[model samples]
Target: MATTDSDTTTTDDTVLSMENVTAGYGNTTVLHDVNVAIEDGQIACLIGPNGSGKSTLMKSIYGFADVKAGSVHFRGQEITGRSPQANLKNGISYVLQDASVFPNTSVHENTLMGGYVFEDDEKAAQRAEVLYDEFPILGDIRQQDAGTLSGGQRRLLELARALMVDPDVMLLDEPSIGLEPRFIDDVFERIEQLNDLGTTILLVEQNAEKGLSVADRGFVLASGEIKFTGTGTELLNDEQVGRLYLGG
Candidate 1:
């Protein structure tokens, strides 16, 4: 459970919380006093203009960026400044924006790598089998080098790998970036399926329209601070949000 500070309020069903968090890469801050909370089992998206710290928000939660101030909590436990590996063990998984799979390794190997924190290879293999079953394309080329797969296939493999940990919350950065239209739809559907299966998702997406279309709640960030927070449909209907961020 997370320890609460006077500055931060605890809300029921909040799986993740960032209270006045100021974080960024080394020697520079991208996010400033950001307060964002995500409820359990909801597909929440962070959408903003380019360089609005949308990606930085995900990094802060995953511990990739340096937190200069404030707090980060997962399921009521304080995890500020925790190493990424430690957070992963504690059921927080971060799927980064760029390609994260190993090009030289076999697809099976890449999937198994998700469980590097596990001591039992057999257990990891079982999880990989389940994932392969869910993502049949990974099964089809289990022995092939991951580099040989198409762009969308590689992204799917990354998601399958992330699931090996059975994380409570998955922080995904730009899952639909650089994919074909069909593949983009497939990615969103996969996100829906994952959320349906009980994973709380916090997504940072460049495709605001499509991202908000599937999200239960939407957050808009501008200049490193949260500008709007509402249900996806609510933000979609907001005239200001639509005009500024959704390319109206």
Candidate 2:
């Protein structure tokens, strides 16, 4: 299948979108004329080689990167250049690629941190409890120090914490990165479960095949530009995409 520009077209169902966005850090642009839209209740995957601005794109959406041009919209409202704090308050949660837990904090406490935007402490605690019900393993170790968790446990903790806000959109940067094969599958399963529960997700994944396997839509980006866009299966089966990005 050949790449098309239709992925940039936003529709009534579009929950998150970037139009002609040029973003990067401190005047050093990493993305160029990027256009992508994620529909409501869909799992969209962005796959590219290292240094291809995948993480930058995630940051751009979450207000971590500077959008030098164009606009970003969420639920039809413009949010270009919004602060990270504001973005979180507006129901956008980001799970970073790097370690993000407090080493000395208890597991339950870390989970509560996700609801920092909540005006009441009790509500945050209640939200954490609800998340624990969805992630029983975290509930079982609520008292353990975050530093003591395994890699997979830490990843799950990150996911649960991010959900503290009950976000409408989740920007997951390399969710399965650095995990063992066993843990990787578990993380992906959790991602699917989240999508099933009504959270629209935009994921930047290193494992091209596995990422697209679960994605409802897929985008291929390179050198700070979008190169392809289609249904997950369409991109996965594309001869060029397979030979280049998928290592076929």
Task: Provide the TM-score for each candidate, comma-separated.
Answer: 0.95, 0.98
**Pairs that collide, model 1:** 1-76, 1-77, 2-76, 2-77
Clash-forming residue pairs, model 2 = none
lDDT by residue (tens digit), candidate 2, 1-248: 54665546999999999999999999699999999999999999999999999999999998899999999999999999999999999999999999899989999989989998899999998898899999999999999999999999999999999999999999999999999999999999999999999999999999999999999999999999999999899999999999989998
Q: Which lDDT tens digits does candidate 1 get at residues 1-248?
A: 11112323458889999999999999999998888888899999889999999988888888888999989999888999999999999998888999998999999999999999999999999999999889998899999999999889989999999999999999999999989989999988999999999999999999898999999878888998888888888888888888888988
Candidate 1 error regions (>4 Å)? 1-10
The lDDT per prediction is 0.89, 0.94
